[model samples]
Target: MSQPVIALFTDFGVSDPYVGQMHARLVAEAPQARIVDLHHYAPAFSPGPAGLLLEALVPHLTPGSVVVGVVDPGVGTARGSLALATDEHWFVGPDNGLFASVLEAREGRCFRLREPEGDGLSVSFHGRDLFGPAAAALARGDRMVLGEEVAEPVRAEARRDAVLYVDHYGNLMTGLVPPEDGGARLRVEGRNIPFARTFGEVGPGELFWYRNSLDRVEIAAREGSAAKRLGAGTGTAVAWIGGV
Candidate 1:
């Protein structure tokens, strides 16, 4: 039989034993399961970034994989653990509103869970006791349920109509749209803004926003950090007032 594949995504950096212990627990439960690390460096509790990375990596993972994502900032809160079933794979994690909207967007199947036989359910470390062993059991060909289906989750909206992610060079990377055949207009923080294809198009040292290769509006300075100037980062709301 083919070894079951389990993908681990967590904010637990390699500097600690938390991640390792989870792996050990999983292996102890399901010996034939193949464990793969999707990533261990998720920005602490920054599920938005974690979700974005998870979505981007989805295409590259093998089919029929069980992906365990534990970016739980509210670990011991009333938040519950979940197991999502998609046409291709299973995604398990805390349902403290982390990427639930994104998961629903992909038509995933969700299940609410309880502990399995011989599994100790610990609220403080569900990733190890709950997620790890459950994934292992599923890998061992055991049928299990983790959560129930629900309506789509609510998502954050861009204040204007775009967001900004800082680039390696510290560019604000806004979401303002470019001018059309006539002219393009955008809005930000309730104020209208103009678009520039290049930094030079804007006055020297002045801030401007424009669409880039990804087509999302980006905020940038003529030769500086629009982020530093605007005091914003990814998820900073901006609106595409008008563009063609």
Candidate 2:
């Protein structure tokens, strides 16, 4: 079998030392594993939207890859650690609903992660000290190092009609999937945004909704920022105006 790929997904922006530290630990602990920086700028302190994005992106990842997801707002608190094994992927992170959408979208098994007994884990940086090691272990096929299996992981109530993320181009990625008919209009900020095939399909500065690469409903301007034009950001409300 080929070496497993370990992907990192977190809100730790690239400028910080947190992400680099996790990378160093993974490299040292699982030298044979391949590491991929899937994403770092997930919605800060908001795991529900991040989870929705993760659910959409997970299917596009390499098969059997281990994803280390960390969007924990309650890191130092009593929040439990989790290790999830889906049909095609493994996820290690806090149990504060960071992996909720992944579990909901697939058949998976959840385990409470077992922290290193005397590794001097830090309260504020579980992503580096705890999840990184667990992901490396899973990538190395050492499931025994994880804790006992759990019946189910914690699930959060995610808003399907909210903006999950905004890209650098100002495209607003909503949590909703495109309608099967492909004719539904999106209502946002009191404006009815129609669907377009792509940015070129709309006039310059005109706003339209389209199915993004991940198949999620996204609002974008032809050559401008839909987020700026609509005065919207992450967690903005979106509604489907047309019928099913």
Candidate 3:
């Protein structure tokens, strides 16, 4: 039998010990599952753009996988926790609209996470204390960690016209899909970027927009950093020639 896939997504950079603790906790909870580090740099303290980026990444995950996304700025607050089950995957995260864009566009059922047992949960680090274990349980097909069903977890206004993430290569991944017209241009940070099929189609250092692997409109500067060139990062507004 194949091992279940448990993917981790968070804002905790690899340089910190937070991500390591999450890995250890997951291993302790569900050792039989295969853990995958989906991403750790999720536009720190920004859950809206992070959630949108998570939604965009849904198509790339293995079917029946469990994803634990932690970009909570309200970790220690009165906010709730969530275990969301979609058709192809399960998502465990805080209820602070971290799963908003995913649940908003797709058909998903949300459940409140049960209070953590065995160990004392850290108020500020629910990723390792709560969500990580719940995700492990979900990956193992054990639903005991999930509590009551959430009628509606939380809702967020996703800006499809804004940058959702800036990858390490400095590519600007936006929430907006490319326009139907192939020749459309994307306006960003006071400059109009033309559309290109791919990096090879444009000259090095030239700024352009293209449909990324995840099918989102992305800004890039061949052989250069688009973010640096445009002085843009996550939440940077973008629009097509006719408008977003």
CA lDDT, every prediction? Answer: 0.68, 0.89, 0.88
Candidate 3 per-residue lDDT over residues 1-244, each given as its tens digit: 2688888889998998988899898999999988889889887887788888888888898777899999998988999899998888899999978889888778989999997766678889999889988888887778899899999777665788998889889999999876676678878999999989999999989999999999889999999999999999989998777764
Better of 1 and 3 by lDDT: 3
Q: How many clashes in each candidate?
A: 23, 0, 0
**Which 10 consecutive positions of candidate 2 have the poorest summed lDDT?**
144-153
The best-first sequence of candidates by lDDT reads 2, 3, 1
Candidate 3 deviant stretches above 4 angstroms? none
As a whole number from 0 to 100, the lDDT of residue 208 in candidate 1 is: 68
* Local accuracy of candidate 2 as per-residue lDDT tens digits, 1-244: 3888999999999998998899899999899999899999998898888899999999789898999999999988998889988888999999988898988888888899888888569989998899999998888888876788888677776897999999999999988889887878889999999999888888999999999899999999999999999999999999988555
Worst 10 residues of 3 by lDDT: 177-186
Point to the candidate with the largest lDDT.
2
The count of residue-pair clashes in candidate 3 stands at 0
List candidate 2 stretches off by more than 4 Å. none
Q: Which scores better on TM-score, 1 or 2?
A: 2
Clashes of 1: 23
